[model samples]
Target chain A: AQTVTQSQPEMSVQEAETVTLSCTYDTSESDYYLFWYKQPPSRQMILVIRQEAYKQQNATENRFSVNFQKAAKSFSLKISDSQLGDAAMYFCAYQKGATSGTYKYIFGTGTRLKVLA
Target chain B: GAGVSQSPRYKVAKRGQDVALRCDPISGHVSLFWYQQALGQGPEFLTYFQNEAQLDKSGLPSDRFFAERPEGSVSTLKIQRTQQEDSAVYLCASSRRVDQPQHFGDGTRLSIL
Candidate 1:
C-alpha cells in the first residue's frame, strides 16, 4: 500500500517568517507526481504546487516551494514570507502514473499551519 | 462551466438514511475522482473514473458506499444505511487529462446524526 505521512500535526509561524512542513511517503512505483494543497476556513481545497518524480528540480510557486527527495520518498513544503492569509491545513500528496501517464494521488495526513500576528 | 462543482454543500442524515452526493466535473474533463476526508485529516481517495467507466473503487470504505458516472460527466456518490463513521467531507475533483492538474469543488459536508 502507498502511504504519505506529514509528521507535523500543527505549526506556528509569525507573520513574515518562513516555515517548512515535512512529508514522507512509502511507495514502490518509480514514476509519480507530488503536490501541495491548501485548505482554508472557507472549506475549499486549492492546489499550491506540483512536482513530477522524473524531474530532479523542485517545484515552486511564488510563496510556496517544495523540497522533493525522490530517493528518500520525502516531499516537504516551504512557505516563505508567510502571511496571515497563508494559515491553513497543508497537505502533501503523491500520485503514481498510469500506463497512459495519468495517475491517482495519495495524500498525507496534513499539517495545520497557524500564521500568528 | 468553470471549476468542479458539488451539490448539497451540507447534509445531515440519520443513521439509517440514504444520502446522495453529486459532482459536476469541469467541462471536457476526462478524469474524475472522489475522496473522503475525515475531520482534520487529508482527503483519502475513494474512487476514480475515466469517462463513464469506473476504473477504481478500491478506496471505497465498504460495499455500502457506491459511486457512478453514467455519461462520463456528472457523478454521484451514494451511501446506503450510513454509519456514524461515514460522516465526513466528501470531495470531488477532475482533470482535463490524466496528467493535468486537478480542479476541486468545495465539497459536501455530510454529518450523520
Candidate 2:
C-alpha cells in the first residue's frame, strides 16, 4: 500500500517571503504521480501542482513548484512570494500509474499554512 | 457543470437517520471518486466509479455506506443508520480520464447530532 506523509502539521510564512512544505511517501510501484492540493476555508480543494514519477524535471506552476526527488521518495512544495491568500490546508497525494488499473488517491494528513503579514 | 458540484452544502442528521449526498461530476468526466474527510484531516478515499460502473469500493468503511453512479454523471453516497463517527465532510471529485488530474467539489459537510 502507498502512504503519503506530511511532516509539518502547521507552517507560517511572512507575506512576500518564501516557504517550503515537506512531503514523503512509500510506494512499491515505479510508476505513479504526486500532487499538492490546497483547501481554503470554503472547503474546495484546488490543485497546486503535480509531478510525474518518470519525469526527472520538477513541476512548476507559476509561484508554486515542487522539488521531486524520486530516489528519496520526497516531493516538497515551494511557494515563492507568498501572499495572504496562500493561507490554507495543504495536502499531498499519491496515485498509481495509468496502467495500474486503480484510481484512488492516498492523501497525507495535511499541513495548515498561515501567511503572516 | 464546469467542475464537480456537491449538493446540500451542509447536512445535519440525527443518529440512526439516513442521509444522502449528491455529486455532479464534470460534463464528460469518465472517472468519479468519493472521499470522507474528518475535521482537521485530509480526505480519505471511499469509493470510485468509472462511467456508470463502480469499479472500486474497497475504501468504504462499512456495509452501511453505499454509493452509485447510474448514468455515469450524477452520483450519490447514501449512509444508512448514520452514526456519530460518520460525521464529516464528504467530497466528490472527477477527472476526464483515469490518468487526468481530478477536480474536487466544495464538499458536503454532514453533521450527526
Strongest candidate by TM-score: 2
Task: Kindly list the per-residue Cα lDDT of model 1 for residues A1-117, writing each as its tens digit.
Answer: 788999999999999999999999998888788889999977788999999989999998998999988888899999999999999998888888755343667888899999999
Model 2 interface DockQ? 0.91
Chain A alone, TM-score per model:
0.94, 0.99
Question: Which candidate's DockQ is highest?
Answer: 2
How much does each candidate deviate at the interface, measured as C-alpha RMSD after superposition?
Answer: 1.6, 0.6
Q: What's the lDDT for all of these models? A: 0.91, 0.96
List of clashing residue pairs for candidate 1: none
The docking quality of candidate 1, as DockQ, is: 0.71
TM-score of chain A of 1: 0.94
Q: TM-scores of all models?
A: 0.96, 0.99
The collision pairs in model 2 are: none
The list of candidate 1 runs beyond 4 A from truth reads A100-102
